[model samples]
Target chain A: MRLAAVLLFLATISAICHTDGYIEQVTQQIHLLRPRSGAAGYRLKDVDCLSWRLAVETNNVRNWKLVPEECEQYVGHYMLGKQYRKDCEIVAHSAIEYAKSLTLVGDGKDIWIFDIDETTLSNLPYYARSDVQFGALPYNDTKFNEWVAEGAAPPVPGSLRLYQTLLPLGFKIVFLTGTAERFKDIRISNLKAAGYYTWEQLILKGEADQGTSALVYKSKKRTELVDSGYRILGNLGDQWSDILGDNSGNRTFKVPDPMYYIS
Target chain B: MRLAAVLLFLATISAICHTDGYIEQVTQQIHLLRPRSGAAGYRLKDVDCLSWRLAVETNNVRNWKLVPEECEQYVGHYMLGKQYRKDCEIVAHSAIEYAKSLTLVGDGKDIWIFDIDETTLSNLPYYARSDVQFGALPYNDTKFNEWVAEGAAPPVPGSLRLYQTLLPLGFKIVFLTGTAERFKDIRISNLKAAGYYTWEQLILKGEADQGTSALVYKSKKRTELVDSGYRILGNLGDQWSDILGDNSGNRTFKVPDPMYYIS
Candidate 1:
């Protein structure tokens, strides 16, 4: 009986040790790597708060005040309109600052290429409206341009400050996107709504190039920029593709994208 | 200054939120998937205690009783050795009990596969000597087989009982390893030293033309087992690959490998 009891005890211990339930193992591995004080338990509380906020945003209640039309206008005016609205003014300023920052002494002129989606526009409101966190959806170009043309987009944080700083600096801004050129009217109208009027070029993927991978499309856009006699100063985007152009730029800055993938 | 302080305070809170990091993300994903957490964190105290004890045994100083030819054997025999001695006696008895419990099929042929490393012999002594937690250096096959033939492996908790029980119940035992066949003699010797001499086969990698990919090699091993006309009743290993046969299995039992990758 004593032996049996001992065996049972050993069995119990072994069961506890061996199971690969992932959480315990992961927690253990992390703890092994970085010992944390008891205070680390409070991290759960933070997680709870974040999860609650996300849940609230995604729920049936329209409490976050998602102004899609305003958002579009905000994106268009600042990204293109060159106006100095308090919230949406960064795009124009950064464009000018960036222009001056470039010293293209060689035969190649400098091009400032940008990514679409979160880089140029604020899309958290749209995510809030759709109640989706990471799901893929089609671009409603008509509605998007309509909103942009209205100049209703609230300025994205840190964007206008940089844009305003860049533009007066003498670098010609170029907008490159995977959005097909078939949506040129809406795209242009959207930028105009946001106050974007002129640029060296605003290149979008053609209709025949719709289903190709974003990397391939973006590479092609860089080639176009190069052909246009511009040495890329720096590419700015939320995604890796924008910054990964061949010999296009000397530096790359990535802004955080809290919502949506262009790919 | 007051406004700046407030802005800093808000920024601190926001930064804290972002730093919540990968743990929260993985936990949230797990919760969303709703997997059975069955027997996972169920025995946390025991798991912690066991891991702690192992750490102590590996680290303790006065425990050094053997040095020269048996320096390796000394650690294995005394620390893990004693544990195995206890396990073998218990498991031998339990194997009989387990054998009675099994309902043998009409085929009257059953096979038991054991994962090497932590599953059978004490591989920890090798790692313990080097104080390296990660990489396993290439095996010294001749030396390993000699050690194995010497019959000096410590028993993992609960393993002997299971192995013992299954043997008498008409189950043939085999040791299958991702370790190459060059070490087969040492491996066999090692098993014999541990009182596990009934192994019908010692299957190793690169022997029967199965390449190094974990998925492919394990599946190939299973094909050999099935072709031999024996039903795989239960598989024991320290990795997911050991039991998840070329993507099929009957019953799977796993042990923890705190040292290195078995797959």
Candidate 2:
């Protein structure tokens, strides 16, 4: 009996040691994975936040080329009015149903609003180079015009397919942006570069009232779109400011901006 | 016997279904996480084996800022360098180390090399803004030098610490860049703005080689460091080209460049 009891005690001690060791290993693993401590520290947080702060400060300074501030403004600066493309398409397709039910304007055709940068054309890649070089911010209007004339800005992902789908359904496309009036020629060139030829109207940022603030720039731009005599069925842009009328709307579609945006 | 056989049949069916479902789920998860299928989709087979052809062709065009050719060059532009304060603390340290190791030249502690963009100043934020408003490639030299002169460019993370660490060691500092030599006043102003009072040399791109390949341009510049009798112990810049020698002994350190490197 004594021998059996001694064996049990030894077994119990060994089991306890194993369990303690296992717990220690797991604790260490967790500690390592935790961001607030150890080798695998808050690396992502440091890089993302610091880089963003740096980008912002750099944009506000000397070489107009480092437009980090511009990127931040982009999210609020341009938005496709529809919350999602599918939602916008659905609402656009059903506009005829609504038109049949109401007195309607001159015609019951559909109109779509598109934000410029990430909608039919992408301009971020061109800007990314400027930040990298840090030499001098170049604004060669001739070169810009030439680039836009080339009409090589590829359609945003899923934009061409959807645009084609809507075109066949009697939907008229309208391009809108918070771009100042000075860039009219360049804007047209860029759209043409993207193989986009037949937009009904292009709405850009117009001069505002005496009290216009930077935040309201896009909102004012949207009011212009609303006044343009088109029953806005859907809106698309990368920024929230493009979609929301006063900036508020039902059907708003947005593409991701891995490169940059105003908001 | 009949009951046992029935039970076995049911168990087999259950096991087969479970195994099949498990296999399908695991396969789907695995596929979702792979590079070709991953969320970010940036997996390359190997750094060397993966050509920049796809990234260049797809991401670079006329509208994009950095051209395809430049993108291709960027992949192989990795180099090592370190940054120090203009106060000459780090230079002095390096000079002491050199004197201990080798025979004295003129002063045994004279020249220093500096990179322009991110090292001595900040330029990313300005680039970001131009990208949005301008929608063209970024380049604005006058403004770049102005920012430097303003000294608003924040020290790179940990750079100020390194600079403070190296001063008072007995070394004369020099600044060099691929910028034009004509901007000597601007460059000096920027350094002063950043708290760097004086430099033994302020070499610009034209002073080295006008329009040669960046790599070749950098190699020629290193000879000046040698000719100056300054035992180049540690060089500092954001890009690899700043510190890398054709064939020599210089301890190199790197500061991460999230914005992008021009050369």
Candidate 3:
């Protein structure tokens, strides 16, 4: 009976060791497999967050809903820090210097393209509201449309300076936006109120463009501008799709946007 | 006895279901954690490969060793296909066009910087050998140094054309390499044999640069060049460190390099 008991004790010890080994191995594997959350303090710890971020920013993935937890830090950084403002200022400064070196044709054909929303206008106030805070809720079109109709959004700080500089340099300034044509009057009022006084054209998506992706619609519009004998010298935007695609201008500058992504 | 048997059966079923649920949860987590390998056929599935590639290419992370498996696809893509050649040709074509548009000051100070290895010279033959295939072995400095001493690596395709184009355009061609200055004779011979007949300067790292990282060494060298009244209009290389840092020229173009990375 003592021998049996001794054997049982040995078996229990062996089982405990095996279980500990298994747990350690699994934990190590989990550590290896987990995606790095850059810098730390981020909630999401998977490649889904990274891939989605890159895809949306680069315009490789379009028109996808964002989970709240995934975008919290991005939104927080944009809304709460000076990083975004500094980035815009630096990009604008570079654009100014680059433009100064160019000898314009003096034919009014040299043009610069600007995008609305986060590029030329700020919408942080709307995004900061409790309903849309952290991007937790699905994007509500009606609410956003109402906000646009208010025509109260301010200018994106550095962009107005860039706009004013390009105008006197003999380059025609054009505003191209993904906002629907229905909001044209309100967008114009908002732009004018925000210190964007004059532009050659304000191009917006029409009913016919509703079915197509932003890339297709924007590329088509750019081609039209090219065909109209306009030389797109510089294109600036907060989204990759705004500066990419056909006839994407001579030089494209991307302004940083982390609060929300547009397709 | 019947009640005990029933209870035992229920417990077994519950354990099996629990095990299955645990497995399903783990698999889902794994899927979320895995990095998208881009375009397909890549073997590495973890985020380490993706982050490392981005960090190295963007000059965010430097002076790091690469695991063999993570770099296998990069090596394979470089050695087995014409993708690398095509990318070089396209970049060179754009550079040619950009240079053609410029009206040079004709001061003999307009300079174009070229990196030597993988930028101007191809080392495919050495990398294709069985002993060092797939970067499976740790980097052998002695073997690589011997290969450099051979004076046999061919000129990188399209780079030769670019070099020829720039020479006649009144742009001073400068070769900046991280290779030690001790191999100056062999490197010059290699360049001469590979159709790079003349260059304004061939700057190689010296003993004083040995202790510094590539970025510091290269950036310091570039500052010296700039202080000498040289106008660096265009700089081209296969590494991010080559085109980044102090006095890194006006326009920098990156040629593709998937085989290996240098700090």
Best by DockQ: 3
Query: Per-residue alpha-carbon lDDT of model 1 for B5-44, expressed as tens digits?
Result: 7547645643211111112211111001111221111111
- lDDT of model 3 at position A62: 30
Could you give the CAPRI-style class of model 1?
Answer: incorrect
Go through the candidates in order and give each one's C-alpha lDDT: 0.46, 0.42, 0.65
TM-score for predicted model 2 compared with the true structure: 0.32
What lDDT, from 0 to 1, does candidate 2 have?
Answer: 0.42
Q: What TM-score did chain B of candidate 3 earn?
A: 0.76
Q: Write the per-residue lDDT of candidate 1 for residues A98-217, one digit (tens) a residue.
A: 444456564426556776556665554543343221211223445444544443444355565565555556556788766556556766765655555567778777766665556567
After superposing candidate 3 on the true structure, give the runs of residues whose Cα lies further than 4 Å from its correct spot. Answer: A1-263, B1-64, B67-71, B134-136
**Compared to the true structure, candidate 3 yields what TM-score?**
0.45
True contacts kept of each: 0.00, 0.00, 0.00
TM-score of chain B of 1: 0.55
The reply for model 2, stretches above 4 Å from the true place, is A1-263, B1-112, B130-152, B247-249
Error of 3 at B44 (Å): 7.2
The CA lDDT at B30 in model 3 is 7
